[model samples]
Target: MQNTTWGAIMGQPFGVIGYSNLGFVFDRDRIHEYQTYWPKEETGLARDVYIGFKYQCVEYARRFLTLKFKAAFTDIPHAHNIWALDIIEDCTKEEGTFPFVNYPNGSKEPPQFGDLIIYPYSKEQRFGHVGVILNVNLEEKYVDIGEQNYEEAGWECPEYARRLIMKIENGQYFITNKRIGKPYDNWDINEEIFGWKRIDFSQKQ
Candidate 1:
């Protein structure tokens, strides 16, 4: 893909990332950026049901689903109460609200494109992490994800979304590389995978 201004702003190609069959086809024409916010305040804050609070992993995932598939979710807490695991549980309970189907790790069925990959927090961590699958290669046993906030690129980290690779082995999935970002790097595959949920477009009615 030709390097455009947006690609230069993102500091990477909006196209394929090398010979790896596992990669993403980013919409270079689209402006992909959002403000980062955390640590919910007691003061009243306006929340957009679709775009969500800027720069949050959950926000981006929700926005992606809404824009890409025209899906929406309700009854979700507007504040920090919405944890990564909460997303899986919420979708499971409110079946037809969002186009998500929960799948625990080690299931015979693996994650596919557009799946929301959630990582649970460890004892040292306070909050979990989340990402969206951009590509999945079952034969190669790997998945590419688009995520925000988990990295340590300063305050605008959320707008600086990037792709990372996750591996699957012995019917289990794990993130082997620690270079993607912090807090996320601290997550161990054995303990972090609370589960993943796929956005079933067919469910949209």
Candidate 2:
């Protein structure tokens, strides 16, 4: 948004950290881990899947955007414990079914306090998972999103044969994308834990 030092440091850019930058160097190892599999679900707990808030929000901020996975992982510092406590309660749900709600802007968008973290209730191969959309990108995609490791929030991969874009639809959140040059949608997993969304800290009272 503002792209200020704070934001820049928080989102993982390039040439943004160094030995002089203690903030960046603090969690350098995590960058190594994120690079190992980040932007790719292949990254799991023992493999980079830090499923909880640490991995979802805080650790996510640590990701620095760069062709190098480690560079992307160095995006933010001190994010782990920062966002674990907030909750987004204002997200607009549609028909409680499969529907994509539009988050306009300013006052019109959902007053989503933090990241709207959703856990997978089910699993279909590598597709079953979780994600965070802390705020609505009003100017650009207007698409609600958060720290997506893998690639630009990691929504473009077609795992499980053909799956991409994890979403919460009809009271159920699932992953969808495409396989073999085709659209593949909705692989509901109504039974998952650790998945969470973030509430806007600035908006909190």
Candidate 3:
């Protein structure tokens, strides 16, 4: 199937609908080439348990954590079937599997690398979106993210994992898209963030 554009799927149903950039294979040789590949319906083992649709944001986040930190979060539901917000809830309920600490919107604690950032669902969207925190600079107040499903939109929208500027005021965190050589565009984290989950390996027992 041809890749669907952001505009084409804007008012339609959201969630993993086979539209991906990771193609079919989970190439360990080129695992770092996340941007070039589309997520497909491949499956594999993480903690001696089944995982979900490959190349999707949920799958990539889980595999990335398992491969990079030896942390396995197998309790999360199928990426293709579940809402993005439910992943956080599932992780929070799972005991002694993988540490999934949830920080609500406007959280004071800064997000760290490998954290799962959850976006809120809108009236038109049935499910929200997810991304992995690639970098965080509290001093500079910006974060770099790694995600799928958010492809480029011709000349308007940016591609996966753009750097976003963040701010903390009145005990709340806010974010803005940082475009090179252009004015910073404020992104409503207050409205967009349902919550963020961090993989705390320390909780594994």
Best by lDDT: 3
Alpha carbon lDDT of each predicted model: 0.46, 0.29, 0.49
For residues 61-107, could you state the per-residue lDDT of candidate 1 as single tens digits? 66555545444343344312233322221222224443356676666
Which has the higher TM-score value, candidate number 1 or candidate number 2?
1
Task: Write down the worst ten-residue block by lDDT for model 1.
Answer: 12-21
Off by over 4 Å in 1: 1-48, 75-99, 153-191, 201-205
**Residue ranges of candidate 2 with Cα displaced over 4 Å:** 1-58, 61-114, 125-129, 134-142, 146-182, 189-196, 199-205
Between candidates 2 and 3, name the one with more favorable TM-score.
Answer: 3
RMSD each, Å = 11.1, 15.3, 9.9
Kindly list the per-residue Cα lDDT of model 2 for residues 36-119, writing each as its tens digit.
233334432122322222233333433322221222221222332222333222212211111112221122223232322333
Residue pairs with clashing backbones, model 3: 20-38, 21-37, 21-38, 22-37, 22-38, 22-39, 23-38, 39-55
The TM-score of candidate 1 is 0.54
Model 3: worst 10 consecutive residues (lDDT sum): 9-18
Give the Cα-based TM-score of candidate 2 against the true structure: 0.27
lDDT of model 2 at position 46: 23
lDDT of 2 at 73: 21
